[model samples]
Every structure is written in C-alpha cells, then in structure tokens.
Target: MEFNEIIERIVKSTNLSAEVLNSKINDKIAELDNLVSKEGAAHIIANELGVNLIDSDASQDFVNIKNLVGGLRNVIVLGKVTDTFPVTTFEKDGKKKQVGSLSLNDGTGFARVVFWDDSINIFKNIKENDIIKVINAYVKENKFGKLELHVSYRTKVRVNPDDIDPKSINATDKQSKAEFVDIVEIKPDSFVKCFGAIVQVYKKNIFFNVCPQCGKSIKSDEGLSMCSEHGKVSPSRKMFVTFVLDDGTGTIRCTSFGRDAEVIMGMPTIEAIKLADSHEDSTFPVDSIKSKILGKEVFIYGRTSLNTFTNSIEIITSRIVENIDYNVELKRIAEEVEFGDKN
Candidate 1:
C-alpha cells in the first residue's frame, strides 16, 4: 500500500485524531526522522504529501518581511540577533530616550525589528547569537519598498536560554525549494532560463599551410595570395562556425562547431565540417529568424556565458521545447518586472 494509506490505516487502528495529538511532539519526531534520513526525509515526505514543508508564510509569532502584508497580525518567532544597529538617543533638556533597529534570522527567513525608547533597553542587552522571543510584533512596508517588522510598546521581548538549542528550533523549522517559474515571476534572486537553433557559421581565423622555419599560422605562399605578415610561407586555415536558435519570443546566436557543436546542432560530421569551412560573413536576416522562432518554444536556463576567443557573449541554454505561447511568457515577464520594482 502507499505511504498515505498506511498512515491512514494506522491512525484508524489507533482511533487517534489531530485534536488529541500534540503538534509539537509530532513535529519533533518527524524532524528527528528527517535529520537521520539519508536524504532530507522530512522535505521528501512533505513533498510527497504536497505540504508546504517550510514555514515560509507569515505567522503571528514571527513576522518575516518577505511575506509581510499591511494590517496583518504578526508572528511570534525565536531567533538569534544576527545583526544590530546602533542605539540612537534623542535628548530634550535633561531627558533622554533610546531607539534602534535589529535584524534576526534562524536560516529559514529574516526579519528586521525596530525598537523604540522603552524597548531599546531590552534590545540593547541583546548580543549576537542570543536567542530571543518576540511577541505581538507586526510588519510594515518601508520607504525603499521593502517590508520591516517592528516591536511596539505592547510587544514583549524575552531571552530564553533553553531555546538556545538549535535542535529544539529545528523541530519546528521548515523550508521549501524555489519553484522554477516562481523564481522568474517573483524576481527573487534566481537563475535565467532559455532555448533555440544554429543558423550560420563563420571562420574567424585560418592557417592555410605551414612555415618552413616557424610553425605558426601563416598565409598561402603561392601566387594565389602573397603572405603579408610572413615573408613566404603557407599556413593551415582555422575554422569556427555560428548557429542561431529560434524560440517564440526571440532568436539567439549560439556560435559553436566541432564534435560538441555537431551533437547539439544535430548535424553530421561532414556537414558540420562543411558549415564551418564556409566563412560566409553573412547572417540570416532578423525577419527570417523571427518567423522561425514564432512557432517553436525551447527551454533554457543559465547565467550568461562569455566567449574569450571571439570577445562575444553567448547565452547558455538547455531543455529545448517547441510550440510555446510567446504571449503568455511576455505577460509573465511584464508582471514580474512590475512586481520587482515594488521590492
């Protein structure tokens, strides 16, 4: 039987229900099992169950900035004060008051908490690596288009030495892998993906024959063409080729040749060599490329690659697919850009 069915049978046999179960205890046991598993058992099980394993969503106990919403009840969180700002005191005559901001994280996510005068004394005692509990905190959007959580007068802060144990927090901790499409949509510091075809080839350098003395790239010594750099020598001609790939949104040039290039281009050994030999300094027109790309959609993702030899940029791609809706992609890109501007 499947895992879920087995779990259900066990629960039915025991006549146990969530109302009688201790969430913290169960979470701890699961976390322990996950930690001991060969490969992230907790996350794997959570994935199989379609559960949001990580506590990524905002909670009333801990108000994380990334998931903050205006006028929402904040979360209670326990984490070390990873970073702290200086406490600035405003003075009026003989009176003085303290104020500052601090950032905390427990590897899952982060939150910046601002402290006022009364709370400054409590926060001032907070040192790096000190685990503290925050209650009744909330998040608000800052001027720079980022969310920040602050502790108000009603909020309470306390240092819990027992909670210093990482294992205790691990039992409650959760994390999720980034979604491929969401990375692009959310603009949350992600890698770029694309796909397309080879269209043209160009021979940048070639050695026709060899020199009698110096073995280097030389021009043809025959009357057909006199060597300008060399006195009188024949050199081998070097060959390189360029290929253009078309995706619905755009056509990109991926210039490569030889065995590796032929494999990706799906060209025969002889055909690949012929294309490389034709140093036609001509490129397929943009209109023709657009027409080809309009029908096919390929998938690619990678950081930009630079060609040191040719002093050009070639984007690396993978997972080529065809017949994609370019308009949908365009709309997604537009929305992501617009949303990223808010952050």
Candidate 2:
C-alpha cells in the first residue's frame, strides 16, 4: 500500500476511538489529494476537530489573484464582509438609488460583495472590521475584468464583529514575498511580479481588416487589410498583446493597453502608430514587436483586472524588463541567432 494508505490503516487500528482518529486521517488524505478539493473536506473536519486549517495550498486555485477570483465558480474562504459605506445606482426601471458594496476579505485577499434592495438593509447594519465566514459564493467579472465575489441565494455567511480582528487575521501571501520581504503586508497598490511570454504586439498605425460582425481580422480583397464584412467601414487603430503567465498555480493572460503598451513594448507612440499604418491593409510581421519579447519569460509589475466574461486577467499597469535573470534560455537564443547569421 502507499504511504498514506498505510498511515490511514495504522491510524484506524490504533486503540484510539474511531471518531477522533478517522476524522483527522480522512482530512489528511483529502489534503494530500489537492488543495482546492480539500477545502470542503477540511472545513468539515475542522468542525469535528475544532481546529482551523491554515495555509494548505491555495496555489491550485489562486493562479493570479485576479484570474482566480474571475474563474472561481463555487468557493469557500474564511474572510470578513465590509459594512456598507456609500453607494449610488440607477435601476432598470428608470429609478436611481444610493447603494453600497459589502467588501469581503479574509486578510489574505478581498472581493466586493454587492448587496441590492432588501439585502442593502442587512449590509448597512454591519460595522467595519466585522469578521464574516463566506461559502457558496460565486465569482463574477466586472466591466474591466476585475473579479468580484458575490453571495448567491445559496451562499452561507456568518458575521461576528467582536470576535475577529480584521487586521490580525493571517492570510497566505502567494506573491510579493521575495522583493517586498521587509513589508509586513501586501497593499492593494503595491507591485507584484507577473511572468509571461509576449504572444502578440500591436501598434495603433498597423491596420488589419477585421470582420465587422465579429470584429475578427480578415484578409481584404484589395490586398490591403480591410474588414470586407464592414465593406466601407473604417478599421480601428489599437494595439493589443496576448501573453501567457503562470503564478505557480495556473497559466493566465497578461494584457497591456494604451500607454502601457508603448512603455512595456519599448515602442514610441508615434512609431507604433506608423507601424500600424504600414500594416493597415495587410498582415504585418510581428517581428518588431515579437523580437523584443518572443519565447522569453518576461517580468511585469502592474494592476491586474479579472475578465469575468473570459475568466482571465487584463493586466493594465504593466511594464516589462527586457533582460531578466533567466539567463540559460537567453544564452541559447544568442547561439541560435549567431548560427543564423553564419548561414
């Protein structure tokens, strides 16, 4: 039998009562399986054992804070919901009212918990620094792709203002541990490293024909790129980069927009515009943008937004480091370029 199986069997045969030993043994088995799957099992065991499970492995679920929050379907976290502050909203019925969001945080991370209508009353009564336990909450993405956690009809939430210290609650710090070791906490605006490869580079002047109906680029009959679907409609000039990065949990998209694109890609605004213009009617080579960052692992620090619709992050405040410490791969690339020159 495997080591865990042996332990489970041995723990079972012990003179100790089955209730005490079985609960713990089963929980251990569940934990060994994977972190995300163990949550429910661990929570159940915690109830029976009267002990909190700390720092198991959120790596599986938290690929990136934004991506994880965006992709989460049904999840449980030990956190608190912020009391109502102030909110304003316009209703579909042509009515407008001030509303507030219940910000939920377990000290490790936070999510905006929206309360509407009658639910607003319950939230308004909550005081700041209150500790709340949340379960069965669903993750939704905002317009900007930031993940916001919501309390569904089936969500189970427990609120206790006096028993918990909003600040004292220890949370798992996945990123920002290396460089910011001196910092006791990860602030919202603090910078964190993101890893990914540059899959695309866009310049505002580069023109590519896209389908008017789907917004997908298509080859124009004129030999110049034009959205034949739109027939006479003008093509848009915008730069977009798609990159894949992993945070020891899972791989996610890292995007840069507008000015951020110029800074990260080292392309001046006017130059980028000119490049876009040259490619406007045809598929331009991604060389200028691609050569700067191709298969290399680049590090970026910026704001991450969770795309709820696509279940990914749209990294905005991003800047790239051309030369990183991962030298072994770069050296190989250097050799390859040298050989190509010789040919």
Candidate 3:
C-alpha cells in the first residue's frame, strides 16, 4: 500500500483532514528521529489512537498473483494496487449493473480483480500503488485467456498494514508448478495442466442453444426453449467444441466452451454460428478448426469431466497454448514423473 492510500484510509475511517494527518505524521517522524517513513509514522500515530490499518489476518494462504487459476474460491491475495479502471454500467434485468476492474501485483505477477455491483464502491477512491488485500475472492478466466480474481458476496477489501514488508513479497521464487499433467492421469472435475497433440477433433453437436440471461445452454422442451431457472426464453447459439489430446500414455477428449471456443475458431462464436446458419452443409469452419488445431502439441489448462453422451471422461480446457518448446516441457515432465533413474 502506498502512503496516499494510508492517508485516504485514515481520513475515511477517522473523519480527519488530510492536512492535519500529514502534519501529525511528519511530527511523529521527527519525534522518532526520522527512523520511519511517512507511512510508517502514520501507522504509529494510528496505533497510538488504537486504530487498525488494514483488516487482514496474517494466517491467510496468500499466494503470488501468477499462481491464480480457475476453480479456486475464498482466495486471500495480498498485493499492491497497480492499476484501476473507470467504473462501467450495463443493463441487466432492467437494472443498471455497475462493474469495475483493477490490477493487483505482488511483484511475482499481476492479476486483475473485477468488482461487481457493490464491490465497485470500495475501490472508487483507490489510487495506484496502494497496497491492498482481498479476502474471500474467487478465480475465473476471462475472454482473453487470463485468470482473474472476482469480488463476491463474501469478499472483503483491506488496505495496507504496518506489518507487511514489500521486500518480503518479492517474486524471485514464486513461479507456479502449475503446468499440465500427463493425459492418462487426469481426474474428474479437476483442473489439469497438460500438453499433448490434438490428434483428432470430434465432430458432433458443436453448436447449441444458450440462455441470454444466465448464459447456460437452454434445454428444448417440445417446441419451447427453456432455461431451468428462467423459463420460456429466447435462446442464442453457442459453441461447444471438443477435441482429442494424446500424451503417449493415453488419449482424452478436451472440451472448450464459449469464449475459449471462439478462440479455437479464430473468430467470434456468433460469426461462426451465422456462417453455419447460412451454409447449406451446416458444417461451417470444420475444415478450418481441423486444419489449425489438429496435428499440433498444445498446452492445456482446464477441468476434466465425464461426457455423459459419450460416457467417457474428457478435459475441459479453459486455455490452450500452441507450439510449446519441447525441451522445457520435457524438463517439466521429467520433474513431475521423476523419470531419470527412478531410484
């Protein structure tokens, strides 16, 4: 957290003027023989008044930003506020829903946090470089293939505390061991990191109906398209792509949805849907998807699940990176499997 955030927090929490707090902070620094910075001095004064700085429990399993992946919940992250964007509003269910996004960096890497509805107000006055702590956050991947933290109903926002040392939070040793596992070792509903060749691309119902409101696929009941929660709705077409991944040990189908599907298609899903609709063959982009994605070794990070229709377990990849360096991947595989002497 920066000194500005401390000062702002102090003023907001105590109804004190910035000028008065600045003067007292300077005085405390002088009294302490210039031993502490302005922020440190302000913290001392706040402590003397029996006030808390940032409300974070030190016991939290706060990891570096780069370690964040999807399927994580109740995450506690401690990072400096690096960037903040303007709040934007969009209509949802006839009411304006406001959202805001900001970047938090812990020197290891930066992760974005999106504040929804009421959470946006917490960072409305936040400034760049303000040290921040997010409590009970959730992780999800955005459209652009980046993992992000989201402020939820249980989320709490805290500012800088005196106990934290920025130097101690350096990124030198915090890189993730989060690469893909071998294809044969995948388990149900677990996010697996693995790289394998796209041996085949499955051709089935690659497109489906989706409810606009909740964004889940709408089920067809007779002639009526319906959502389980929001019934009798107009539906939109969505992409549901599946492909085979081979890691020598075994092959498993990898599924991707929506934004990830769009990425694989190299075009917006809606555009693909339109092309499919216009074409008499109804197999639009099949050749293109096969040409680009198949016969390639791609890195995948996604959850594994059993496809009910096929009764076979498959990986649902959230993100895929193509044309990985073979030497580095082999090293990671060796470390994970202890493949050398096996002593």
For this target, which candidate reaches the highest TM-score against the unseen true structure? 3
Quality of model 3 by C-alpha lDDT: 0.71
- Could you give candidate 1's per-residue lDDT for residues 105-178 as a string of tens digits? 65555666667657888888887556777776655543323344567665788776553564444322211111
Q: Write the per-residue lDDT of candidate 2 for residues 131-219, one digit (tens) a residue.
A: 66555665665333434555544566667745445665554333323231111222333455544455545433333334546676666
Native-to-model Cα distance after best TM-score fit, residue 72 in candidate 3, in Å: 28
Report the CA-based lDDT of candidate 2 relative to the real structure: 0.49
For each candidate in the order shown, give its overall lDDT on alpha carbons.
Answer: 0.46, 0.49, 0.71
Superposed by TM-score, candidate 3 places the C-alpha of residue 259 at a distance from the truth, in angstroms, of 2.2
Better model by TM-score, 1 or 3?
3
Candidate of highest lDDT:
3
Mark the regions of model 3 whose C-alpha exceeds 4 Å error after superposition: 1-179, 187-190, 306-312, 323-343
Worst 10 residues of 3 by lDDT: 171-180
Candidate 3 per-residue C-alpha lDDT over 1-343 given as tens digits, one digit per residue, 9 for 90 to 100: 6788878878887867999999999999999999999889988878876677766654336866778887577788888775565566766557886766766778767777877667878978677667788888877654455667877667898877576775566533111324347777777777667766878876665688889899988889999999999999999778878778888989998788877676555567767777777774446666556787677766667777887898888877765544323344334334533632363
For each of the candidates, the C-alpha root-mean-square deviation to the true structure, in angstroms, is 21.0, 21.3, 18.6
Selected candidate, larger lDDT, 1 vs 3: 3
How many steric clashes does model 3 contain?
A: 4
